[model samples]
Target: MASEFELIARHFTPVVSGSRTGVCLGVGDDCALLTPRAGQRLAISVDTSVVNVHFPADAPPEAIGHRALAVSLSDLAAMGAEARWCLMALAIADADDDWLASFARGFHELCAATGTTLVGGDVTRGELAIGVTVMGEVPSGQALTRDGARPGDVLAVTGALGAGAGGLALWQRGERDMAHPLLMRYLRPQPRLEAGRGLLDLASAAIDVSDGLLADLGHVLKASGVGARMEVDSVPMAAGLVEALGPDAARRAALGGGDDYELLVSLPPDAMDEAVRRLASQGLALTPIGRVTADPGLAGVGEIGPHGWQHFHGGAS
Candidate 1:
Protein backbone atom coordinates (compact mmCIF):
# COMPACT_ATOMS: atom_id res chain seq x y z
CA MET A 1 0.00 0.00 0.00
CA ALA A 2 1.31 3.42 -0.87
CA SER A 3 1.42 6.13 1.77
CA GLU A 4 -0.30 9.44 0.95
CA PHE A 5 2.93 11.23 0.16
CA GLU A 6 4.11 8.37 -2.01
CA LEU A 7 0.80 8.40 -3.86
CA ILE A 8 1.02 12.11 -4.56
CA ALA A 9 4.67 11.92 -5.59
CA ARG A 10 4.18 9.08 -8.03
CA HIS A 11 0.91 10.21 -9.56
CA PHE A 12 0.38 13.93 -8.91
CA THR A 13 3.57 15.96 -8.55
CA PRO A 14 4.91 15.47 -12.06
CA VAL A 15 1.72 16.80 -13.61
CA VAL A 16 1.85 20.01 -11.58
CA SER A 17 5.15 21.11 -13.10
CA GLY A 18 3.85 23.09 -16.03
CA SER A 19 3.33 26.88 -16.14
CA ARG A 20 5.21 29.22 -13.79
CA THR A 21 2.67 31.93 -14.62
CA GLY A 22 1.29 33.19 -11.30
CA VAL A 23 2.47 30.37 -9.09
CA CYS A 24 5.16 31.53 -6.68
CA LEU A 25 5.39 27.98 -5.40
CA GLY A 26 3.41 24.90 -6.46
CA VAL A 27 2.93 21.43 -4.99
CA GLY A 28 5.38 19.84 -2.51
CA ASP A 29 5.31 22.90 -0.25
CA ASP A 30 3.79 23.64 3.16
CA CYS A 31 1.21 25.62 1.19
CA ALA A 32 0.96 26.53 -2.46
CA LEU A 33 1.88 30.19 -3.03
CA LEU A 34 0.46 32.46 -5.72
CA THR A 35 0.66 36.03 -6.93
CA PRO A 36 -2.05 37.59 -9.03
CA ARG A 37 -0.98 39.70 -11.99
CA ALA A 38 -1.15 43.45 -11.81
CA GLY A 39 -4.77 44.72 -12.03
CA GLN A 40 -6.21 41.21 -11.85
CA ARG A 41 -8.41 39.66 -9.15
CA LEU A 42 -8.45 35.99 -8.27
CA ALA A 43 -11.71 34.13 -8.76
CA ILE A 44 -11.72 31.07 -6.54
CA SER A 45 -14.35 28.37 -6.23
CA VAL A 46 -14.50 24.85 -4.81
CA ASP A 47 -16.70 21.90 -5.77
CA THR A 48 -17.03 18.42 -4.35
CA SER A 49 -18.21 15.09 -5.72
CA VAL A 50 -19.10 12.05 -3.62
CA VAL A 51 -19.39 8.44 -4.63
CA ASN A 52 -22.96 7.28 -5.33
CA VAL A 53 -24.20 10.80 -4.62
CA HIS A 54 -22.56 12.86 -7.34
CA PHE A 55 -21.48 9.88 -9.41
CA PRO A 56 -21.96 6.16 -9.48
CA ALA A 57 -19.63 4.23 -7.19
CA ASP A 58 -18.62 2.03 -10.10
CA ALA A 59 -17.92 4.87 -12.51
CA PRO A 60 -14.55 4.94 -14.30
CA PRO A 61 -11.93 6.60 -12.11
CA GLU A 62 -10.78 8.74 -15.02
CA ALA A 63 -14.23 10.20 -15.51
CA ILE A 64 -14.56 10.84 -11.79
CA GLY A 65 -11.28 12.72 -11.74
CA HIS A 66 -12.17 14.83 -14.76
CA ARG A 67 -15.59 15.75 -13.39
CA ALA A 68 -14.26 16.72 -9.97
CA LEU A 69 -12.09 19.48 -11.38
CA ALA A 70 -14.29 20.30 -14.34
CA VAL A 71 -17.17 21.33 -12.11
CA SER A 72 -14.99 23.70 -10.14
CA LEU A 73 -13.55 25.23 -13.28
CA SER A 74 -17.05 25.95 -14.51
CA ASP A 75 -17.37 28.52 -11.74
CA LEU A 76 -14.29 30.31 -13.01
CA ALA A 77 -15.75 30.17 -16.51
CA ALA A 78 -18.92 31.89 -15.30
CA MET A 79 -16.84 34.71 -13.89
CA GLY A 80 -14.91 35.04 -17.15
CA ALA A 81 -11.71 34.15 -15.38
CA GLU A 82 -8.62 32.65 -16.96
CA ALA A 83 -7.55 29.34 -15.51
CA ARG A 84 -4.41 29.51 -13.38
CA TRP A 85 -4.23 27.15 -10.39
CA CYS A 86 -6.08 24.35 -8.64
CA LEU A 87 -5.79 22.35 -5.41
CA MET A 88 -7.34 18.96 -4.97
CA ALA A 89 -8.24 16.93 -1.87
CA LEU A 90 -9.11 13.27 -2.08
CA ALA A 91 -10.72 10.83 0.36
CA ILE A 92 -10.68 7.20 -0.60
CA ALA A 93 -10.95 3.84 1.12
CA ASP A 94 -7.59 2.69 -0.17
CA ALA A 95 -4.58 3.90 -2.14
CA ASP A 96 -5.20 1.87 -5.25
CA ASP A 97 -2.17 2.62 -7.39
CA ASP A 98 -3.68 1.96 -10.81
CA TRP A 99 -6.79 3.91 -9.96
CA LEU A 100 -4.77 6.82 -8.67
CA ALA A 101 -2.64 6.91 -11.79
CA SER A 102 -5.66 6.84 -14.07
CA PHE A 103 -7.31 9.54 -12.00
CA ALA A 104 -4.23 11.67 -12.20
CA ARG A 105 -4.14 11.26 -15.95
CA GLY A 106 -7.69 12.45 -16.24
CA PHE A 107 -7.18 15.38 -13.87
CA HIS A 108 -3.94 16.48 -15.47
CA GLU A 109 -5.28 16.17 -19.00
CA LEU A 110 -7.69 19.04 -18.42
CA CYS A 111 -5.14 21.05 -16.49
CA ALA A 112 -2.72 20.78 -19.36
CA ALA A 113 -5.35 21.54 -21.95
CA THR A 114 -6.56 24.63 -20.08
CA GLY A 115 -3.14 25.82 -18.92
CA THR A 116 -4.18 25.44 -15.27
CA THR A 117 -1.58 24.25 -12.78
CA LEU A 118 -2.20 21.83 -9.97
CA VAL A 119 -1.01 23.65 -6.87
CA GLY A 120 -1.50 21.42 -3.83
CA GLY A 121 -4.04 19.22 -2.05
CA ASP A 122 -4.52 16.46 0.53
CA VAL A 123 -5.29 12.78 0.44
CA THR A 124 -6.73 10.69 3.26
CA ARG A 125 -8.50 7.46 4.08
CA GLY A 126 -12.22 7.89 4.07
CA GLU A 127 -15.32 7.51 1.93
CA LEU A 128 -14.85 8.11 -1.78
CA ALA A 129 -14.91 11.86 -2.42
CA ILE A 130 -12.97 14.47 -4.42
CA GLY A 131 -12.93 18.19 -3.79
CA VAL A 132 -11.18 20.77 -5.91
CA THR A 133 -10.50 24.44 -5.33
CA VAL A 134 -9.74 26.23 -8.58
CA MET A 135 -8.35 29.74 -8.91
CA GLY A 136 -8.35 31.99 -11.94
CA GLU A 137 -7.40 35.57 -12.66
CA VAL A 138 -9.77 38.14 -14.08
CA PRO A 139 -9.17 41.82 -14.71
CA SER A 140 -10.16 43.86 -11.70
CA GLY A 141 -13.80 45.07 -11.87
CA GLN A 142 -14.42 43.00 -15.02
CA ALA A 143 -15.43 39.62 -13.68
CA LEU A 144 -18.92 38.57 -14.68
CA THR A 145 -21.59 38.06 -12.02
CA ARG A 146 -25.22 37.04 -11.75
CA ASP A 147 -26.23 40.44 -10.40
CA GLY A 148 -25.29 42.47 -13.47
CA ALA A 149 -28.28 41.49 -15.57
CA ARG A 150 -30.88 44.16 -16.18
CA PRO A 151 -34.26 44.74 -17.77
CA GLY A 152 -34.27 44.56 -21.59
CA ASP A 153 -31.16 42.38 -21.63
CA VAL A 154 -31.24 39.29 -23.77
CA LEU A 155 -30.69 35.92 -22.12
CA ALA A 156 -28.54 33.59 -24.20
CA VAL A 157 -26.88 30.22 -23.75
CA THR A 158 -23.74 28.77 -25.21
CA GLY A 159 -24.40 25.46 -26.91
CA ALA A 160 -27.34 23.10 -26.42
CA LEU A 161 -28.73 21.74 -23.12
CA GLY A 162 -30.19 18.57 -21.50
CA ALA A 163 -27.40 16.31 -22.75
CA GLY A 164 -25.93 15.66 -19.31
CA ALA A 165 -29.26 14.78 -17.80
CA GLY A 166 -30.15 12.77 -20.85
CA GLY A 167 -26.87 10.95 -20.49
CA LEU A 168 -27.64 10.13 -16.89
CA ALA A 169 -31.00 8.74 -17.92
CA LEU A 170 -29.35 6.48 -20.47
CA TRP A 171 -26.79 5.33 -17.94
CA GLN A 172 -29.51 4.51 -15.44
CA ARG A 173 -31.08 2.29 -18.07
CA GLY A 174 -27.91 0.15 -18.13
CA GLU A 175 -26.70 1.52 -21.40
CA ARG A 176 -22.90 1.63 -21.35
CA ASP A 177 -22.14 2.81 -24.85
CA MET A 178 -19.23 5.15 -24.25
CA ALA A 179 -19.40 6.44 -27.80
CA HIS A 180 -22.90 7.76 -27.32
CA PRO A 181 -22.84 11.57 -27.25
CA LEU A 182 -25.40 11.86 -24.51
CA LEU A 183 -23.68 9.18 -22.41
CA MET A 184 -20.34 10.94 -22.71
CA ARG A 185 -22.07 14.15 -21.77
CA TYR A 186 -22.89 12.64 -18.39
CA LEU A 187 -19.33 11.42 -17.93
CA ARG A 188 -17.36 14.36 -19.33
CA PRO A 189 -18.81 17.85 -19.44
CA GLN A 190 -16.70 20.52 -21.16
CA PRO A 191 -16.71 23.86 -19.43
CA ARG A 192 -17.15 26.85 -21.76
CA LEU A 193 -13.90 28.55 -20.83
CA GLU A 194 -13.05 30.32 -24.08
CA ALA A 195 -16.61 31.28 -24.83
CA GLY A 196 -16.96 32.74 -21.35
CA ARG A 197 -13.88 34.90 -21.78
CA GLY A 198 -15.26 36.12 -25.07
CA LEU A 199 -18.37 37.26 -23.23
CA LEU A 200 -16.50 39.15 -20.52
CA ASP A 201 -17.05 42.57 -22.01
CA LEU A 202 -20.24 41.61 -23.84
CA ALA A 203 -22.45 39.96 -21.24
CA SER A 204 -23.92 42.03 -18.48
CA ALA A 205 -24.04 38.92 -16.29
CA ALA A 206 -23.34 35.23 -16.71
CA ILE A 207 -23.75 31.88 -14.99
CA ASP A 208 -22.75 28.36 -15.85
CA VAL A 209 -25.66 25.97 -16.16
CA SER A 210 -24.87 23.26 -13.64
CA ASP A 211 -28.43 23.39 -12.48
CA GLY A 212 -31.19 23.33 -15.10
CA LEU A 213 -31.47 26.35 -17.39
CA LEU A 214 -34.69 27.72 -15.93
CA ALA A 215 -33.54 27.23 -12.34
CA ASP A 216 -30.13 28.79 -12.92
CA LEU A 217 -31.67 31.61 -14.92
CA GLY A 218 -33.81 32.37 -11.90
CA HIS A 219 -30.67 33.22 -9.96
CA VAL A 220 -29.72 35.85 -12.53
CA LEU A 221 -33.25 37.18 -12.46
CA LYS A 222 -33.40 37.52 -8.71
CA ALA A 223 -29.95 39.01 -8.45
CA SER A 224 -30.60 41.51 -11.20
CA GLY A 225 -33.96 42.47 -9.70
CA VAL A 226 -35.80 41.57 -12.85
CA GLY A 227 -37.91 38.90 -14.52
CA ALA A 228 -37.77 36.95 -17.76
CA ARG A 229 -39.87 35.80 -20.70
CA MET A 230 -38.61 32.69 -22.41
CA GLU A 231 -39.58 31.15 -25.70
CA VAL A 232 -39.28 27.45 -25.05
CA ASP A 233 -38.93 26.79 -28.75
CA SER A 234 -35.81 28.90 -28.80
CA VAL A 235 -34.02 27.00 -26.01
CA PRO A 236 -31.59 24.73 -27.79
CA MET A 237 -31.75 21.02 -27.02
CA ALA A 238 -28.73 18.80 -27.13
CA ALA A 239 -28.23 16.99 -30.40
CA GLY A 240 -30.09 13.66 -30.35
CA LEU A 241 -31.97 14.66 -27.21
CA VAL A 242 -35.34 14.66 -28.93
CA GLU A 243 -34.61 11.27 -30.48
CA ALA A 244 -33.50 9.78 -27.17
CA LEU A 245 -36.25 11.20 -24.97
CA GLY A 246 -38.90 12.43 -27.39
CA PRO A 247 -39.66 16.07 -28.03
CA ASP A 248 -41.68 16.74 -24.86
CA ALA A 249 -39.44 14.89 -22.43
CA ALA A 250 -36.39 16.29 -24.17
CA ARG A 251 -37.71 19.80 -23.83
CA ARG A 252 -38.40 19.21 -20.18
CA ALA A 253 -34.94 17.85 -19.61
CA ALA A 254 -33.38 20.75 -21.47
CA LEU A 255 -35.33 23.03 -19.18
CA GLY A 256 -34.45 21.34 -15.88
CA GLY A 257 -31.52 18.97 -16.43
CA GLY A 258 -28.32 19.73 -14.53
CA ASP A 259 -24.61 19.42 -15.43
CA ASP A 260 -24.90 21.24 -18.73
CA TYR A 261 -21.84 23.41 -17.94
CA GLU A 262 -22.78 25.88 -20.67
CA LEU A 263 -22.80 29.59 -20.00
CA LEU A 264 -26.08 31.45 -19.72
CA VAL A 265 -25.40 35.07 -20.44
CA SER A 266 -27.44 38.24 -20.22
CA LEU A 267 -26.59 41.05 -22.57
CA PRO A 268 -28.32 43.97 -24.17
CA PRO A 269 -30.50 43.17 -27.21
CA ASP A 270 -28.37 45.12 -29.63
CA ALA A 271 -25.28 43.22 -28.58
CA MET A 272 -26.78 39.83 -29.39
CA ASP A 273 -25.49 39.68 -32.95
CA GLU A 274 -21.95 40.56 -31.96
CA ALA A 275 -21.92 38.08 -29.09
CA VAL A 276 -23.21 35.30 -31.31
CA ARG A 277 -20.73 36.28 -34.00
CA ARG A 278 -17.84 36.18 -31.56
CA LEU A 279 -18.71 32.72 -30.25
CA ALA A 280 -19.44 31.49 -33.75
CA SER A 281 -15.89 32.30 -34.74
CA GLN A 282 -14.82 29.90 -32.06
CA GLY A 283 -17.16 27.30 -33.61
CA LEU A 284 -19.56 27.52 -30.67
CA ALA A 285 -23.22 28.48 -30.90
CA LEU A 286 -24.73 31.21 -28.76
CA THR A 287 -28.52 31.12 -28.80
CA PRO A 288 -30.81 33.78 -27.48
CA ILE A 289 -33.68 32.10 -25.64
CA GLY A 290 -35.35 34.91 -23.81
CA ARG A 291 -35.27 38.51 -22.65
CA VAL A 292 -35.09 40.07 -19.25
CA THR A 293 -38.04 42.10 -18.06
CA ALA A 294 -38.94 44.68 -15.44
CA ASP A 295 -41.58 42.36 -13.93
CA PRO A 296 -40.79 40.61 -10.67
CA GLY A 297 -41.00 36.95 -11.82
CA LEU A 298 -40.64 34.64 -14.74
CA ALA A 299 -43.25 34.36 -17.44
CA GLY A 300 -43.01 32.12 -20.43
CA VAL A 301 -44.86 30.96 -23.49
CA GLY A 302 -44.91 27.64 -25.37
CA GLU A 303 -44.14 24.64 -23.13
CA ILE A 304 -41.70 26.41 -20.86
CA GLY A 305 -41.70 25.30 -17.22
CA PRO A 306 -39.64 26.27 -14.20
CA HIS A 307 -37.57 23.34 -12.98
CA GLY A 308 -33.97 22.53 -12.03
CA TRP A 309 -31.66 20.63 -9.70
CA GLN A 310 -32.06 21.65 -6.06
CA HIS A 311 -29.80 19.58 -3.79
CA PHE A 312 -31.73 17.68 -1.05
CA HIS A 313 -34.99 19.20 -2.20
CA GLY A 314 -35.50 17.21 -5.39
CA GLY A 315 -33.31 15.37 -7.80
CA ALA A 316 -32.51 16.76 -11.26
CA SER A 317 -35.16 16.14 -13.88
Candidate 2:
Protein backbone atom coordinates (compact mmCIF):
# COMPACT_ATOMS: atom_id res chain seq x y z
CA MET A 1 0.00 0.00 0.00
CA ALA A 2 2.97 2.32 0.52
CA SER A 3 6.29 2.92 -1.20
CA GLU A 4 9.47 1.41 0.20
CA PHE A 5 10.63 4.70 1.73
CA GLU A 6 7.21 5.30 3.22
CA LEU A 7 7.16 1.83 4.76
CA ILE A 8 10.50 2.45 6.43
CA ALA A 9 9.53 5.88 7.68
CA ARG A 10 6.34 4.63 9.20
CA HIS A 11 7.42 1.32 10.76
CA PHE A 12 11.18 1.51 11.18
CA THR A 13 11.57 5.16 12.10
CA PRO A 14 9.66 4.71 15.32
CA VAL A 15 12.26 2.24 16.53
CA VAL A 16 14.78 5.08 16.74
CA SER A 17 13.12 6.31 19.92
CA GLY A 18 15.04 3.60 21.79
CA SER A 19 18.35 5.38 21.39
CA ARG A 20 19.32 6.71 24.80
CA THR A 21 22.60 8.50 24.13
CA GLY A 22 24.69 9.66 21.16
CA VAL A 23 21.64 10.24 18.97
CA CYS A 24 20.89 13.92 18.45
CA LEU A 25 18.40 13.13 15.72
CA GLY A 26 17.42 9.86 14.10
CA VAL A 27 15.65 8.88 10.91
CA GLY A 28 13.47 10.97 8.53
CA ASP A 29 16.04 13.76 8.24
CA ASP A 30 18.44 14.25 5.40
CA CYS A 31 21.05 12.69 7.68
CA ALA A 32 21.07 11.25 11.19
CA LEU A 33 23.11 13.07 13.83
CA LEU A 34 24.97 11.46 16.71
CA THR A 35 26.93 12.81 19.64
CA PRO A 36 28.76 10.32 21.81
CA ARG A 37 28.99 10.65 25.55
CA ALA A 38 31.88 12.64 26.94
CA GLY A 39 33.81 9.63 28.21
CA GLN A 40 32.69 7.20 25.56
CA ARG A 41 34.16 6.38 22.18
CA LEU A 42 32.20 5.37 19.11
CA ALA A 43 32.84 1.99 17.49
CA ILE A 44 31.48 1.38 14.02
CA SER A 45 31.51 -1.64 11.73
CA VAL A 46 29.98 -2.39 8.33
CA ASP A 47 29.32 -5.77 6.70
CA THR A 48 27.88 -6.71 3.32
CA SER A 49 26.25 -9.91 2.16
CA VAL A 50 25.78 -10.91 -1.46
CA VAL A 51 23.39 -13.44 -2.88
CA ASN A 52 24.79 -17.00 -2.79
CA VAL A 53 27.91 -15.71 -1.05
CA HIS A 54 26.77 -15.37 2.55
CA PHE A 55 23.60 -17.39 2.23
CA PRO A 56 21.71 -19.46 -0.28
CA ALA A 57 19.93 -17.44 -2.96
CA ASP A 58 16.68 -19.12 -2.01
CA ALA A 59 17.15 -18.59 1.73
CA PRO A 60 14.07 -17.57 3.65
CA PRO A 61 13.75 -13.79 3.54
CA GLU A 62 13.52 -13.58 7.32
CA ALA A 63 16.72 -15.57 7.80
CA ILE A 64 18.54 -13.33 5.36
CA GLY A 65 17.42 -10.21 7.18
CA HIS A 66 18.30 -11.59 10.59
CA ARG A 67 21.74 -12.65 9.38
CA ALA A 68 22.42 -9.31 7.68
CA LEU A 69 22.10 -7.54 11.01
CA ALA A 70 23.43 -10.30 13.26
CA VAL A 71 26.77 -10.37 11.47
CA SER A 72 27.24 -6.65 11.99
CA LEU A 73 26.19 -6.88 15.61
CA SER A 74 28.83 -9.58 16.15
CA ASP A 75 31.52 -7.02 15.39
CA LEU A 76 30.16 -4.74 18.07
CA ALA A 77 30.06 -7.62 20.52
CA ALA A 78 33.70 -8.39 19.84
CA MET A 79 34.63 -4.83 20.76
CA GLY A 80 32.60 -4.98 23.96
CA ALA A 81 30.63 -1.97 22.81
CA GLU A 82 27.08 -1.21 23.85
CA ALA A 83 24.56 -1.74 21.10
CA ARG A 84 23.32 1.56 19.73
CA TRP A 85 22.07 2.16 16.21
CA CYS A 86 22.44 0.90 12.67
CA LEU A 87 22.00 2.01 9.05
CA MET A 88 21.14 -0.35 6.25
CA ALA A 89 21.76 -0.31 2.49
CA LEU A 90 19.85 -2.73 0.32
CA ALA A 91 20.14 -3.59 -3.36
CA ILE A 92 17.50 -5.93 -4.58
CA ALA A 93 17.05 -7.75 -7.87
CA ASP A 94 13.33 -7.81 -7.35
CA ALA A 95 10.82 -6.16 -5.08
CA ASP A 96 8.46 -8.73 -3.68
CA ASP A 97 6.11 -7.49 -0.96
CA ASP A 98 6.00 -10.79 0.87
CA TRP A 99 9.77 -11.11 0.92
CA LEU A 100 10.24 -7.57 2.14
CA ALA A 101 7.67 -8.07 4.88
CA SER A 102 9.31 -11.21 6.19
CA PHE A 103 12.73 -9.63 6.08
CA ALA A 104 11.57 -6.59 7.99
CA ARG A 105 9.92 -8.74 10.60
CA GLY A 106 13.08 -10.72 11.34
CA PHE A 107 15.29 -7.63 11.32
CA HIS A 108 13.08 -5.79 13.75
CA GLU A 109 12.79 -8.78 16.05
CA LEU A 110 16.58 -8.95 16.48
CA CYS A 111 16.92 -5.19 16.85
CA ALA A 112 14.35 -5.06 19.61
CA ALA A 113 15.87 -8.03 21.40
CA THR A 114 19.36 -6.52 21.35
CA GLY A 115 18.40 -2.96 22.21
CA THR A 116 19.56 -1.73 18.82
CA THR A 117 17.70 0.68 16.58
CA LEU A 118 17.60 1.01 12.82
CA VAL A 119 17.95 4.72 12.40
CA GLY A 120 18.32 5.18 8.66
CA GLY A 121 19.32 3.47 5.42
CA ASP A 122 19.10 3.44 1.65
CA VAL A 123 17.34 1.08 -0.70
CA THR A 124 18.10 0.62 -4.36
CA ARG A 125 17.24 -1.69 -7.24
CA GLY A 126 20.16 -3.79 -8.39
CA GLU A 127 21.77 -7.17 -7.89
CA LEU A 128 20.69 -8.63 -4.57
CA ALA A 129 22.92 -7.48 -1.72
CA ILE A 130 22.53 -6.21 1.84
CA GLY A 131 24.89 -3.97 3.78
CA VAL A 132 24.52 -2.91 7.36
CA THR A 133 26.66 -0.39 9.20
CA VAL A 134 26.36 -0.62 12.97
CA MET A 135 27.59 1.91 15.54
CA GLY A 136 28.18 1.28 19.22
CA GLU A 137 29.75 3.04 22.19
CA VAL A 138 32.02 2.08 25.08
CA PRO A 139 33.97 3.92 27.70
CA SER A 140 37.09 5.49 26.27
CA GLY A 141 40.03 3.03 26.28
CA GLN A 142 37.67 0.20 27.15
CA ALA A 143 36.87 -1.26 23.76
CA LEU A 144 38.42 -4.71 23.34
CA THR A 145 40.90 -5.28 20.56
CA ARG A 146 42.60 -8.26 19.00
CA ASP A 147 46.02 -6.83 19.92
CA GLY A 148 45.69 -6.83 23.70
CA ALA A 149 46.30 -10.50 24.34
CA ARG A 150 49.35 -11.38 26.38
CA PRO A 151 51.25 -14.59 26.95
CA GLY A 152 49.61 -16.84 29.56
CA ASP A 153 46.21 -15.28 28.98
CA VAL A 154 43.50 -17.87 28.65
CA LEU A 155 41.48 -18.22 25.46
CA ALA A 156 37.76 -18.63 25.79
CA VAL A 157 34.72 -18.67 23.56
CA THR A 158 31.07 -18.01 24.21
CA GLY A 159 28.53 -20.59 23.12
CA ALA A 160 28.94 -23.76 21.03
CA LEU A 161 30.46 -24.00 17.55
CA GLY A 162 30.42 -26.15 14.36
CA ALA A 163 26.64 -26.31 14.30
CA GLY A 164 26.27 -23.86 11.43
CA ALA A 165 28.76 -25.60 9.19
CA GLY A 166 27.18 -28.94 9.91
CA GLY A 167 23.78 -27.49 9.20
CA LEU A 168 24.93 -26.12 5.84
CA ALA A 169 26.33 -29.48 4.88
CA LEU A 170 23.08 -31.20 5.71
CA TRP A 171 21.05 -28.64 3.80
CA GLN A 172 23.18 -28.87 0.67
CA ARG A 173 22.92 -32.66 0.71
CA GLY A 174 19.11 -32.34 0.49
CA GLU A 175 18.76 -33.51 4.07
CA ARG A 176 16.36 -30.80 5.14
CA ASP A 177 14.74 -32.98 7.74
CA MET A 178 18.03 -33.96 9.33
CA ALA A 179 16.91 -34.02 12.95
CA HIS A 180 20.01 -32.05 13.93
CA PRO A 181 19.62 -28.69 15.70
CA LEU A 182 22.43 -27.52 13.44
CA LEU A 183 19.79 -26.41 10.94
CA MET A 184 18.49 -23.71 13.25
CA ARG A 185 22.06 -22.94 14.28
CA TYR A 186 22.89 -22.37 10.64
CA LEU A 187 19.84 -20.21 10.01
CA ARG A 188 19.97 -18.10 13.15
CA PRO A 189 23.09 -17.75 15.28
CA GLN A 190 22.69 -16.21 18.69
CA PRO A 191 25.28 -13.46 18.97
CA ARG A 192 27.03 -13.48 22.36
CA LEU A 193 26.09 -9.95 23.32
CA GLU A 194 25.72 -10.41 27.06
CA ALA A 195 28.85 -12.51 27.30
CA GLY A 196 30.86 -9.97 25.36
CA ARG A 197 29.50 -7.15 27.49
CA GLY A 198 30.45 -9.02 30.62
CA LEU A 199 34.00 -9.45 29.35
CA LEU A 200 34.49 -5.74 28.72
CA ASP A 201 36.84 -5.47 31.63
CA LEU A 202 38.00 -9.03 31.99
CA ALA A 203 38.94 -9.87 28.43
CA SER A 204 42.40 -8.78 27.35
CA ALA A 205 41.32 -9.11 23.73
CA ALA A 206 38.36 -10.38 21.71
CA ILE A 207 37.09 -11.22 18.26
CA ASP A 208 33.97 -12.78 16.82
CA VAL A 209 34.30 -16.19 15.15
CA SER A 210 33.00 -15.41 11.67
CA ASP A 211 35.91 -16.90 9.79
CA GLY A 212 36.00 -20.11 11.78
CA LEU A 213 37.55 -20.36 15.25
CA LEU A 214 41.07 -21.29 14.18
CA ALA A 215 41.39 -18.66 11.44
CA ASP A 216 39.78 -15.91 13.47
CA LEU A 217 41.88 -16.77 16.50
CA GLY A 218 44.92 -16.62 14.27
CA HIS A 219 44.01 -13.04 13.48
CA VAL A 220 43.96 -12.21 17.15
CA LEU A 221 47.31 -13.91 17.73
CA LYS A 222 48.84 -11.99 14.84
CA ALA A 223 47.44 -8.69 16.04
CA SER A 224 48.57 -9.18 19.61
CA GLY A 225 52.06 -10.21 18.56
CA VAL A 226 51.71 -13.45 20.45
CA GLY A 227 50.95 -17.13 20.05
CA ALA A 228 48.11 -19.28 21.33
CA ARG A 229 47.44 -22.93 22.12
CA MET A 230 43.87 -24.05 21.57
CA GLU A 231 42.86 -27.27 23.27
CA VAL A 232 40.69 -29.00 20.71
CA ASP A 233 39.04 -31.26 23.25
CA SER A 234 37.98 -28.27 25.32
CA VAL A 235 36.23 -26.43 22.52
CA PRO A 236 32.50 -26.37 23.10
CA MET A 237 30.32 -28.27 20.68
CA ALA A 238 26.68 -27.70 19.93
CA ALA A 239 24.20 -30.26 21.14
CA GLY A 240 23.62 -33.18 18.74
CA LEU A 241 26.39 -31.95 16.43
CA VAL A 242 28.80 -34.76 17.23
CA GLU A 243 26.07 -37.37 16.96
CA ALA A 244 24.98 -36.10 13.55
CA LEU A 245 28.37 -35.66 11.92
CA GLY A 246 30.57 -38.03 13.91
CA PRO A 247 33.21 -36.75 16.33
CA ASP A 248 35.65 -35.82 13.57
CA ALA A 249 33.07 -33.99 11.51
CA ALA A 250 31.87 -32.11 14.53
CA ARG A 251 35.43 -31.27 15.48
CA ARG A 252 36.29 -30.06 11.99
CA ALA A 253 33.22 -27.89 11.78
CA ALA A 254 33.90 -26.37 15.17
CA LEU A 255 37.50 -25.67 14.33
CA GLY A 256 37.28 -24.66 10.67
CA GLY A 257 33.70 -23.92 9.71
CA GLY A 258 32.63 -20.33 10.20
CA ASP A 259 29.48 -18.26 10.83
CA ASP A 260 28.91 -19.12 14.48
CA TYR A 261 29.00 -15.38 15.37
CA GLU A 262 30.21 -16.19 18.86
CA LEU A 263 32.83 -14.27 20.83
CA LEU A 264 36.36 -15.60 21.22
CA VAL A 265 38.24 -13.78 23.94
CA SER A 266 41.61 -13.77 25.66
CA LEU A 267 41.58 -13.22 29.36
CA PRO A 268 44.19 -12.91 32.04
CA PRO A 269 44.60 -16.18 33.92
CA ASP A 270 43.40 -14.52 37.09
CA ALA A 271 40.25 -13.22 35.48
CA MET A 272 39.17 -16.43 33.78
CA ASP A 273 36.96 -17.74 36.55
CA GLU A 274 35.36 -14.36 37.20
CA ALA A 275 34.65 -13.94 33.51
CA VAL A 276 32.95 -17.31 33.35
CA ARG A 277 30.89 -16.53 36.43
CA ARG A 278 29.77 -13.18 35.10
CA LEU A 279 28.72 -14.62 31.76
CA ALA A 280 26.91 -17.44 33.56
CA SER A 281 24.96 -14.90 35.55
CA GLN A 282 23.77 -13.52 32.26
CA GLY A 283 22.65 -17.04 31.28
CA LEU A 284 25.55 -17.67 28.90
CA ALA A 285 28.21 -20.36 28.85
CA LEU A 286 31.85 -19.46 28.22
CA THR A 287 34.22 -22.27 27.35
CA PRO A 288 37.90 -22.09 28.12
CA ILE A 289 39.55 -23.59 25.09
CA GLY A 290 43.22 -22.85 25.76
CA ARG A 291 45.79 -20.26 26.74
CA VAL A 292 47.88 -17.57 25.11
CA THR A 293 51.54 -18.43 24.68
CA ALA A 294 54.80 -16.55 24.29
CA ASP A 295 55.95 -18.59 21.31
CA PRO A 296 54.95 -15.77 18.95
CA GLY A 297 53.10 -18.26 16.74
CA LEU A 298 49.82 -20.11 16.52
CA ALA A 299 49.53 -23.74 17.54
CA GLY A 300 46.47 -25.92 17.92
CA VAL A 301 46.50 -27.90 21.12
CA GLY A 302 45.26 -31.42 21.80
CA GLU A 303 43.97 -33.41 18.80
CA ILE A 304 43.31 -30.54 16.47
CA GLY A 305 44.41 -32.23 13.26
CA PRO A 306 43.74 -29.21 11.06
CA HIS A 307 42.02 -25.82 11.46
CA GLY A 308 38.56 -24.64 10.40
CA TRP A 309 37.17 -23.15 7.13
CA GLN A 310 39.01 -20.95 4.68
CA HIS A 311 37.05 -18.71 2.31
CA PHE A 312 39.23 -19.20 -0.78
CA HIS A 313 40.77 -22.54 0.12
CA GLY A 314 37.45 -24.37 -0.26
CA GLY A 315 35.41 -26.19 2.37
CA ALA A 316 37.06 -28.54 4.84
CA SER A 317 35.49 -32.03 4.80
lDDT per residue (tens digit) for residues 74-118 in model 2: 999999998888998988766566777788887888888887878
Clashing pairs in 1: none
The 0-to-1 C-alpha lDDT of every candidate, in the order given, reads: 0.85, 0.81
lDDT of 1 by residue, 165-248 (tens): 888878888988878999887788887889989999999999999878888998898898999999778999998899998987
Q: What does each candidate score in C-alpha RMSD?
A: 2.2, 3.0
Candidate 1 wrongly placed segments (more than 4 Å): 1-5, 15-19, 301-317
Q: What is the lDDT of residue 74 in candidate 1?
A: 92
Score residue 177 of candidate 2 by CA lDDT.
52
Tell me the TM-score of model 1: 0.94
Residue 131 C-alpha lDDT in model 1: 91
Backbone clash numbers for all candidates listed = 0, 3
- The estimated TM-scores of all candidates read 0.94, 0.91
Error of 1 at 291 (Å): 0.5
